[model samples]
Each structure stands twice: as C-alpha cells, then as structure tokens.
Target chain A: MSAVEHAVVDQLGTAEARALLMTAEFGRLAFIDGHGPTVEPFAFALEDTAEDTAIVIAVGTGSGARAAVGQTVAFEVDEIDPVRRTGWSVVAVGTLHGAPATVTARPEPWPDPDGELVLLRLPAERLTGRRLRRETRRAGRR
Target chain B: MSAVEHAVVDQLGTAEARALLMTAEFGRLAFIDGHGPTVEPFAFALEDTAEDTAIVIAVGTGSGARAAVGQTVAFEVDEIDPVRRTGWSVVAVGTLHGAPATVTARPEPWPDPDGELVLLRLPAERLTGRRLRRETRRAGRR
Candidate 1:
C-alpha cells in the first residue's frame, strides 16, 4: 500500500477493455469443473478471425479445461501495483471451445511446455473492465 | 519476461496455498450473474474463526458480490512478475454468505469508504496453488 489514501474506481468501455486484454500475457479462466466453479491462470493471446475476436489459451492435455469444452466461461486479466493500489482489470465471457485458430499458435503455456498441449478459445461476446486510480495527499502541499 | 529462459512449475500443497493467500492483499472473486460467469477483484483478508477458515472481503452495497451471498464462488489471488515470468497463484472455493465475524472489521476496500461497505464471507472448502520457478543459464556456466 502506498501513502496514497484515495482511489477512484471507474467502469471501462468495451473497446477499452479489449485493448487492455491484448496487453496482458496471462489471465484466469473460470469454468465449471467436477468440484464446482474453478479458476486457473494461463498464458493467453488474443485471436482475431473473420467472424470475431477470441481469447486463446494453451493448456496441457490433462488440464481440467478439456472437460469444459462448450461451456460458458469467464476470462479475466489485470495489472495491479500492490504498493500503489492502482491498476485495471478486464473480463471477457463467452463460450469455450477446443478449435485452434491461426493465432493460437502464438500463445504457449509457460508451464508444461514439454507436455502435450491443446488450444482452447473463448469468444469475446461480453467484455467489461474497471480502473482503480490512487492518489496521495502530501501534507502542506496544495 | 526475464533474461532467464528456463523455468519450472510446481504444484503447491494445501498448507502452502493458504500461506500464500495470507501474503496477498487482494484477489479476484469469480461468481455467477444472470448473464453468466463473472470475475471482479477485491482487497481481501483471510479470516479464521471457530467454525472454519473464511475469506473476508468488503464491498459497497451496490457491489455485485452482494448477490453472491449463498452462492458457491471461487476466490483467486496471485502475484506474477512479468519480467521474471514467475509467481504463485492460489484459489479457494466455497459458499458465500453474510457474517461479520471478528475479522470483518479489518479489511477495507480501496475505493469504497466506510458506512456503505458490507462484509461478504466465503468459507474456503477447497484451496489449491501452483508456483513458477525461473532459472537463468550462462554459456559454459552450467
């Protein structure tokens, strides 16, 4: 936490959210598993096709997401500075599938690189984001 | 990404996961909305009561998490250094509810001030984590 004691939280627009998502290297994918709602972080890249833009992630063949194909999932990515308490988070929700697009070749999982990996894609149907702004007030400083 | 090109990823035990959770000041709470799955980040603290270990987060009444009461949710927190491409992430899944335990008064949201805030609790039934380790190799220095 910084000496900054004030913050402003603002909701971002769709285009802004998409732009932010493109800047992130990894994000968490929330999907239903045998236990229930589960979230796992994965390195991802944005894929653009003729029809739409999708968030593509690579995971090991044994990863749980393989069972969640066709399910509606939420993908979230954010950059927050713990000390400054300022950052933005963007979330995209849509259907998850196994079809690998041309862009999928670019995203490789940081872990399990040597293992058998598969590409999972989520259509960016709904995207939303929020920005947190932090400011510090110095004493005797106008 | 760090100059270190090689890395190792390891699965963490429950105790290690919980310990990591305690070290982070904020995490993303994944919950369901009428549309579908959604995720939002919030500053949180781990609360240990007589009954069980609960994750406490404070949000304004207008926050979506208020609707998460009685719903099973997944809470995730992680710290990853993009430069080093290494970090650890922990996820806790449980049912959400409204109970201002002794730990409730401690956590304060960054944007929302006092008076309008409400404490939402999640009893962590399942906790898991993973760590990424990066190592750098020099020519003839292996």
Candidate 2:
C-alpha cells in the first residue's frame, strides 16, 4: 500500500516572509466596502523606500478600491500546487494610501474602459507567512 | 510588431460566481486578528443545505480561525494563468460560525501537530466575482 501524506505547517520569519512576498506579482487585497468586508485580486509591485518596502497597485479612478485609502487592509499572496497540496502563503497588513510622487515600480494597470487610473500604496506594517509541506508517513502510523 | 494584449475585466452574476467557486479546492480567508486584518489560505469545501450553500473549513483547536466565529469575513478563491494573465476570482462575504452537528461535506483537515481539529462554517451570505481576459488590439488603437 502507498504511504499516506500529511501536511506540516511551518511559520516563516519576517525576513523570509518579505522575501517570499517579492516573488509574486499578484495578490488579493481585503478591505471594507459599503456592503461589508470584501476581497479583490490585483496586480502588485514592490517598491523599496528609504525605510521599508511598500506594495503598489494601480486601479481606475472609479474603482471601489480607491475608497480603501486610509483604511487598514490585508494583502495576501500564495502559490499552491493542487495535485501535491503544498504551498506557501504570505500576508502583509498595513494602511492603504495614495502613492507619493517619488514612488516607482508601479504595476501595469489593467485596461480600464471606465476612466483614468491611480496608484495606491500599502506599507507592509506587519508580515506573516506559513508553508505547508506534505510528508509521506506509513499508513496507520500516528 | 505583434499586437499588444490588454486585460478586460468583467463582472459575473451570482449563479456564475457560485459555479466558479465550486471549481477550486483552496482559498484565502480574511478576518480581523488582534494585530489587525489578515488573511490565511485554507482548504475549503462547499456544502449544500435546504436553503443555501455554506463554506466549510477544518482547523486545529488552537487555530486563530476559531476567533473568527460570529464576525463578518470574506473568503476568496481564484485561478490565474500567469503566462496568459487571464483568470477568475470569487469572494463570498458572510459571518463565521461553528459547524452544526447536522453539517456534512467537511473539508479534509490539515495535519495538526498540536491538537485536535474542529470544523467551522460560513454561510455564503453574498457572492461576487470577476474575470480578467486578455484581448489583443492593434497598435495605436484606442
């Protein structure tokens, strides 16, 4: 009989978490809207500032995301292999704000048939990550 | 020169959104933590009751997700093709609650090295989704 595989979850440190965040160009942004708490996927780019790294996203002027400015939000990114059921996820918590004039490395804006686009930045105030690894264990083993 | 491709975003209806949600086995759950808002990935399954569908997840006793019970939360799932820059994302907003004994279709719990596991349920009060499609346009075309 084939050995059963179980997942082992590991917590990642700050530096390791930030390193992992840099590897993905897309993420889900969670914020509160009129209805309630909601999440939307966005293309993101990391910018290095004098103090820390910031996540930048470009959205249309009429986008509900524009309202997220000044609000605390969570940005999450992950890479999962469904067949293997193994992956790592990283979440950055911070306040969303309008981008400064000096900001660089903006994500390419999705074509907006509505109006112009604007850039929003979120300084990763706190970072946490976890990795799930599957290991083979003999069947019936506790 | 080859035509440039631009992303076109489309909003999906409720039936379409729920159907898309059923196609994925994993998703990110966003909830408010002690520090602030945060997100974590988890294995999830959809359960059908007489009235509506519910999203179910299993977590260890020590899991922070337990705290999310009774609070409004957002569960998001998406499938993105990095190379093609095309995919769909669905988000369900609802209050988290402890699973009832009558509930069925529990997700397989991730191995917990610490303790026992429990199931949590979130009845998808509201469902929303969007799809990104890449369409090629001739150069200099508006």
Candidate 3:
C-alpha cells in the first residue's frame, strides 16, 4: 500500500494567537501602496496594556510604511519548518496610527544615520491564527 | 567612546531579484479578503517559460486563497538573520488566476485527505527587492 500525507489545520484562540505572535521578532505587513497591494517585512514589538495590545514598528522617513498609517493593515507572524511542512501563523488586523507618547516600547529603528524615523502602531483589533500539522496514512486504510 | 550601527538599503535589479526568489521554498501571499487585507504563507514553485514567470500555489477548497482569484496580490519571499539584523526581501506583484492546463509545474499542496485542492497562478508582473546591510561607525565619525 502506498502512503499519502495529509495536513490538518486547527484554529487557535485569541490568547494562543497572541502568545504565538510574541515568539517571532519580525513579521510581514500587508497594505495598499500607490502601485497596489504589497507586503513588506518589518521588525516589530508588542505593546501590551490594560486597554489593548498593539503592534509597533519603526520606519525611516522615506519608508513606504509611513503611508500605511491611518489605513487598515494586517500584520502576520509565523514560524514554519519547510522540511517538516508544519508550522503556525498569526494575523492581527487593525488600523495603523501614529504611536502615542504613552507607548513606551517601540521597535528599534534600523541603523539610519541621516534618515529620521517614526513609530507606527496597530492595535490588535482582530486576531486569528492557524496551526498546520501533517500525518502520513496508508492509502488503502479506511 | 560609543559606536552606532546604521542600515544601508540597496535596490536589486529584476534579474537579481528573481535569482534570490529561486533560493526560497515558500513565500507570503498578500491579498484582500472579505475582512480586509491579509497575508498568509504558502509553498510555491516557479513556472518559468519563454513568455514569463509565474508563482504557482495549490490550496484546499476551504482556503481563503480561493477568494483571491482575479485580484491583484503580492508574493514576498525573504531570507533574514534576526541576530545579525540583515537580509534581503523580494516582492512580486501580480494578478491571481486559476492555473491553466498548459502549466506543467505546480506547487505541492499540504496533505489534506478530506479537502479537494486547486491550483492558482500569479505571474510576476512587477518585481522589486531590497537588500539591507549594517555598518558600525564610531560616534561622531563620518
């Protein structure tokens, strides 16, 4: 009998999703640029407060991420093992905004001696995640 | 007395960007779902022809990728070293469509015994990439 591999996907709750997000240092930010929809990687930090959790990123003055402010965007983080074909992904959707003075923790700006930088924050308004698992089964098995 | 690290970002040509893309096994797909803009990772294979190059991904029936058909999307692949804080990222923007019969090579779908799978293709219409390097300088040194 031949064996076939199957994938099982499970949905994680908000707490689990946020927990997973903390394990990753960087994530892809999806938003609409002048050309169209685009995704870029950004190093981010999580800002937790009694009110809400926010994704914070620091971008240089000329960075496109500056335009993303005031727009709804999705920040996604994941850890996957391509060899094992197993991993988990978490997506946080919310409106991007200028970081307020009260936000103490901010993502470190990349070394940019001449370029000014700004902080953008995205509160985790809607969080969702999925875990992928693989199992091998004999094709003839019931 | 102290040193500062700065990031230098370089833009890569189309040919070089495509070369870097070939080194990665998977990428993140950014598209707009009913909820809003979102991104998810997928295993992808590059379909190179005399005419053009396409990114092929196989998804199950329940995959949100199904709704991405006919929409403009961005596929990003990157290799980053968090510890060193340096890496390269490539973004391929294109329109998504159902894979054609003429297409021979396709991405492998995750094992899903109970779900039917379909193939989707995104031709690399506009490709852009950036390489980030770090340089450390003594304080107040040019």
Candidate 4:
C-alpha cells in the first residue's frame, strides 16, 4: 500500500510539521531491530510544544512496542488524492522518548498499564518531505 | 508530493513494490553515516532478476555517491491516494550495492546530475505495508 509515485523534498518550520502530522491518524514507524530493519503500523498522536520538538505517542503489545523505546525511529506519513493523481509525504526520524504527565493525562488513548503506553518524543533530528505533481493540461491545449 | 492524509501499511510483492517505485523518478536513501544518520533522494532503476531479488540501481557524485558504495542502506518509496484516503509505501533496507556492467551502462535519469542511476536489490525482505480504513455504509438494503 506504499505509493511512491511522486515526491519533492522540502523543509518546513517545526510548528508546521507538527500541525501537518496532526491531520493524520496513524503512521508507519521504521526502525532497525535485530539483524535487519523493520517497519510497524501504530496509532499516534502528535504534540507540538517546543519549536523543534514533537511527541508521537503509541501503546501496543507487539515486539515493536518494547524495541521502539529508547531507540532511533523514523515516522513516515503520506496523504494521496487518487483522483487528482497527486500526493505528498513527510518523514521525521528521531528518538523514542517518554511523554509529560500533563500531556499523557489528557484525552489521549495511550494504553495504560492495563496494556502499557509507549511514547516517543521525536526530536526530529532530520525531516524530509516531498510532494508529487499531477500532470495538467491548460484549457484548449491538447 | 508527500501524502499525509491517510496512511496504512500493507504487504506486497516485489513487482507491486517496483511498479510504484518506477512510476516516481526519485525516492529516499537512508544510512548510518559517520555523522549520526543521513537521508538523500536519488533516481533509480529496478531489475527483477531470475534470482528472487528486486534490484534498485542509483548513482551520484560527491554528495552521496561514494558514500553509498559498498554500504548498507535503506531505500523508501511511497505515495498517497486521496480517493482511497490511504497511504502506500515500500521500503527496501539492504546493502548499497554495485550494478552489473549492463546496468551501469544504461542508467536511469534523475532529472539532475549529482543524482545518479543507483541499483537496489530487494531481497524481498519483509513485504510490510498497510492502508487506513474509513467507515462506509454498505448497501441501501442494510
């Protein structure tokens, strides 16, 4: 389900990146586990407090749950418009960290000890984004 | 363009993955550089050898050119589908390998120099993928 059709790399303000992240419900977290690399799907909530910091919180029981903690991770998100044949993606790679108490206590559905909530405060050491352009013909231009 | 609207992971074959990668002229290459981590976008060509491997070949100048040689790297390709409200992505994290003579002769275009024709061999590691599912009513009878 990966559409790598078109992409353009650009850097935006951390605030803007945080807002763009909020528009999505989930993302694929990529990490290097054992002998090779791995990617996992997780539900995440983005929080923008510092100018260059964001928190992606997720709680799961999968192997990725434990390994992701205290490790370098990459979060990949994309929004595609099939009809328009256009789309874009943004990637933020940083460290997996814990969340603030006040932030965790909010309406967030982070898994409690009942399941264990794992959080990652993405410092976003690197952020690369791309947008795909759709072919368009001017009026009366074949 | 980066698709941040809807994204879900799904499993796919090398062909399905290659199809998406080829449609787009460029994708990102990530590696553990001497300086923490680095990611760069490059144009590549995919060759499905008789041997169960999807090869991605790319070339560059001083930028990431030589750095990629003989090193292990991960290449990511993705897109977003608005109508479907889902994101699709494919990542091949393997060795940054050299291309066969034939592959080297006929390289792909990057729409720019520094961007060379690189070759990636998809051991077809993990066909990890997904897509977001939005609720939609079934039939009128229902």
Candidate 5:
C-alpha cells in the first residue's frame, strides 16, 4: 500500500536488526477475526542466547494467549518520540502456539503480574527493518 | 517492558480496532533491538479474502519485508496528529514465509520502493492490550 513507504525509509540489514530484538522486552501482536484484523500490544521475553526470538509473557492458565493456538502471527516493536516525530520499527511474523498450561498454576504468571498474563511460541518466518531518515517527497501533484 | 504494559491495555477487548488489512494499503511495523525499539511504515496488499479468519497481508519479494523471513516482528498502526502526544498502536506477531520469489519481485514493495514499508501478521494467542491514559509510572512498580 502507498502508506507504508511514506512512513519510513532506509531499512537496516539483518544483523543490525537481530541486535534490536535481543534487548527489547515488549511489543504488539495482531490477529484476524470474523470482523477484521485486531492488533494489540503486549510484553514478551526473548531467549537470552537468541537475538531474534521471543517468548510471550504468560497471563493466567494459558487462557490469555489461547487465541493464537493454531494461527500464523505477526508482531511489531519500535520506539517513538512524540515531540520530534522520529523513531524506528521492526516487523516479525511466525506461528503462535500456547506453551501448554503448567501442570499446577503458579498463582502468578508474570514476574510482576499485578494481573495481566499471556504466553506464546513465536517462530520468525521473515525479518525486515528500516531506519528513520528525513527525505522530502518528490516533486509531484499534491 | 513497562512501555509495553500500556500497549496491552488498549487491545485487550477491542475487536473493533482499525488497520484496514483488506484495503490494500500500508501501515507501520514496530520492533525492538539494541536501539531499543523502532518503527517502519510500509504498504501491503491483503492477500486473502475477508472470509479468511487469519488476515494475511502479502509483502512482495525483494522488499524490506522479505527480510522478515525468520525474525521476531511487530506491526504498529496509529493515527497521526503531528501536534499531540495522543495516538494508539496495535501490533501483530509472526514470521514471513516464502510465497514464491515472484511475489517479492513486484515492481514496488510498499506503494513506493524508496518509501518505508512495514509488515504485520495476526497473532494466534489471545489479544491483550493496554492504553496510556496519562503519563504516569506503572502502578505498583514492576
């Protein structure tokens, strides 16, 4: 769609990208339903050794992430500054599967689960990223 | 991780969230890495029909989106006011798969090759979202 290009520029290479994934802790997950597509933001944990993999934070008896039990999935992680209008974004896609309920509930799902909890198996299929750079739109009819 | 907590609140029960997947338009994909997190805006085509429960937006080959072959990814869709710190975000998680090299060879990736392009996928897990009602520290501290 025309909108994507207008929003970003100068994408990064694979290595630069994986580095970003390793340190980040939260992002968004999207799903499609009968009405349309739904996108939601959530927290995730990545394997300490792997740079581009993630584990969704569990939220209650696997009931939270059960929605993506057998569906393809995608996520977006980025940092933005509302004041300057500058930031970068990375996109991820993969299949999401629940981690199967833990035999006995651990009362708390997250290390700090005031209440929210969720878990997911994110396997990346493709990885793409871009950097933020200012460029004037080409001369054209507005 | 704290930043993501707010994101989870907005999408918890919002089935009416926006991001016209079937409109054949583009949106933003946000991700995290060493640079914290980033956002890239791009365009895409809704590859399937409205009936397809799993919203699949095909990213043609050779485009930056193709880089998403096997990496953790997220997509960010928001409305821009350019003056206020008020905007919402929706993210999806998944990996990009091979749809045939021909698909990647499309003339343009996002409406334009030189423009930024972000990709997204629907998550299989239950959707949980948080909204930033006010700029305040997360309750009870994580």
Candidate 6:
C-alpha cells in the first residue's frame, strides 16, 4: 500500500522533541549566507540549562556558518521510514554563539579536523516537532 | 572504527550533486518564517530542463512554506553511515514558486491531506554536494 493511504500526523511537545533531538547524533543546520538560505549536515552535542537548551557544533575555521556567528539558525533532526512513511522530525531555532572557553564538554567533530576547529552554539529559542504514523482506519471513523 | 579516523571530504560537482539529490525520496526544506530560520522535511519530485532543475513538493495549504512564495530557500538531502563515517549530502538553493496548474507529475504528500494541497517549486540555481570517505593511511605517509 502507498504511504499516504494510512498516514497520521501528530504534533510533539517541546520536552519530547528535545529528548528525540538528543538521541540523534547528527542533524542539518539551516542558515542564511551572502548567497541565500543553505543547509549543511553536521554532528552536534546538546547542552541543557535551567532556562534553555543549546546545540554545540564543531565547524572548520573556513566554514561559511562560522562567519554567520550571532545570526539566527535552525537545526533539524529526523528519523523516517521511507517504505512505511512513518517518522518524526524536530527543529530547534535559536541564535548562533561561539562556545565559551570555560565549557569543556564539547563533542568531537566529524571528518576529523585539519587545522583549528571552532565550536558554535545555537541556543534553543524554539523547539517543535511532528510524528507521522501509518495506521489503517475503519470506515466512518472520525 | 570511528568515521573520523580515516575520513576524507570531497566536493561534488553540480551534475553529480543533482544526481544524488534525485536518488533520495525526501529532503528538508529550509526557509524563513516570522520567527526565524526553520526547516521542515518534505517529499519531492524533480523536473529537469535545459534551463534549470526544479524541485516540486506537495504541501498542505496551511503549510508555512506555502507562504514563502518567491523567497530564497534551500533543499537538502543526504545519506550518512554513522559507523563507517562515510556518506554524501547535497544542497539545492533556489527561489520558491507556486507550481503551474498544467503540471501533472507530483510526489505524494505525507501525513495525508485534510483539505486541498498545493504543489510548490524551488527552481534550483545552485546544486552542491560533498562526500565523506575513509582511507587508511600508511605510517610513513605524510
């Protein structure tokens, strides 16, 4: 059967979304550069605080996003079953900040580094997500 | 072994990137809304012409991206091997547009539709990608 034939969509809460975000090791970061809106996949670590949750990403010194410091950014993570069309996607929107020198719990950057790698933060301002499920529905069901 | 131990990153050409993008069934659409930069996963169909390669997405009438007509946007698709630390990611930057009524080819929209659904196009202006691979280095190799 086709995926759309039995798909159901549900919204997820911030807490649940954050929990899912933590489980995924990597996600895509979306930001604006001189050309336009762009996306790049990167590995990230999460930092939770009493007030907010932020994402720590390791980027090369030459990365375009490095120049996008202090700008607004969105990081997205999702798990989808292409065959069944069931999955969940979460997005966190926030301002990008360089990690303070005091923090020492940063995750290791992927593809290993050649030169210096800098850590940038996307302090969580908004967290939202949705889950899709495939379920057969009975006739006349509301 | 970890993905970073022998990882090498390579840039992909426009044709190769577009080909990789066509292999994936779904991708994340990055756009700006009232709040800030946001990302939403979407299923898409590709149309190639002498002029440009356009991404046609089926979205609900109530979707946020539907309101982003004529705005610059980015669509991203990637496949990564967490264990092997190898995979490829492609990003397509373009301007969003409403699809013409005459078009017939469209990918099925996910989560099922409540009311009417519309087809939106992101006419790709730039297509870029990168591949990560592992190569064991000899002890004597620099």
Clashes of 2: 0
Put down candidate 6 lDDT per residue, B1-142, tens digits, no spaces.
3232466778899989988998998888999887878888888889876777898898875468887888999999999887777899899998899988866557778654546888898888988888877777655423
Q: lDDT per model, in order? A: 0.82, 0.85, 0.86, 0.53, 0.46, 0.82
Question: What is the lDDT, from 0 to 100, of the residue A21 in candidate 2?
Answer: 94
TM-score chain B for all models: 0.83, 0.92, 0.91, 0.64, 0.47, 0.89
Per-residue lDDT for A63-94 in model 3, tens only? 68889889999999988888998999899999
Kindly report which residue stretches of model 6 are placed more than 4 angstroms away from their true locations once superposed.
A1-4, A139-142, B1-4, B140-142
Query: How well does candidate 1 match the true structure in TM-score terms?
Result: 0.87
| Candidate 2 per-residue lDDT over residues A15-127, each given as its tens digit | 99999998998888999988898888888899988887899999885457888899999999888888787888899999999999998876967533346788899999999
* Model 1, residue A80: C-alpha shift (Å): 0.8
Kindly give the stretch of ten consecutive residues in candidate 6 chain B with the minimal lDDT sum: B1-10
Winner on DockQ between 2 and 5 is 2
Using DockQ as the measure, what is the rank order of every candidate, best first?
6, 3, 2, 1, 4, 5
Task: Please tell me how candidate 4 rates in CAPRI terms.
Answer: incorrect
For candidate 5, lDDT tens digit of each residue in A43-102?
A: 566543234454455554322345655666666666555334456666666677655463
The structural similarity of chain B in model 4 to the true chain B, as TM-score, is 0.64
Winner on DockQ between 3 and 6 is: 6
Worst 10 residues of 3 chain B by lDDT: B105-114
lDDT of 1 by residue, A1-142 (tens): 2254567778899999989998989899999899998888888878888888898887775467878899999999999887788899999999998865455446867654547778888889999998888656554534
Report how far off residue B124 is in candidate 4 (Å). 4.2
Greater lDDT among 3 and 4 belongs to 3
* Model 2 CA deviation exceeding 4 Å by range: A1-3, A111-114, A138-142, B1-3, B111-114, B138-142
TM-score of 5: 0.46
CAPRI quality band, candidate 5 = incorrect
Error of 3 at B102 (Å): 0.8
